[model samples]
Target: DRGPVPVEEGQEVDVTVDSVGRRGDGIARFNNFVIFVPGTNAGDKVKVRITSVRNNFATGEVVKGE
Candidate 1:
């Protein structure tokens, strides 16, 4: 189940892709909180819209860039 949310649904944010996850999604962080972004790669700088949030991680989609 989802826990405390750091970001709201549809919240847009700019982040740098730090690493790639096991499923090929890009991993970014904010305040040390993890955000998993699909269709992204390591070292990519992009803007994303938060789609879902959980206790330890969140998921978003790339709104701009690779």
Candidate 2:
């Protein structure tokens, strides 16, 4: 039931920062795809550039993770 959503890598995504990771990265989910965004704080709304993509998840380098 879970899989990649055909989003290209390095794409920009605007997401609401849901939580904070152990390394201080922002956690957000989109369309059943989980994205780990680095350099952002929780409760922030920012645009992130997708950096890494896996089957069920992806990683984003904060364009606004600051």
Predicted structure with the largest TM-score when compared to the true one: 1
TM-score of each: 0.86, 0.80
lDDT of 1 by residue, 3-58 (tens): 46668789999999999989999999966779999988899999989999878888
lDDT of 2 by residue, 1-66 (tens): 564475669799888889998888778887757898887777888888888888877898767643
Report how far off residue 29 is in candidate 2 (Å). Answer: 1.1
Task: State how far residue 21 of model 1 sits from its true place (Å).
Answer: 0.9
- The 10 consecutive residues of candidate 2 with the worst lDDT sum are 1-10
Stretches of candidate 1 exceeding 4 Å from the true structure:
1-4
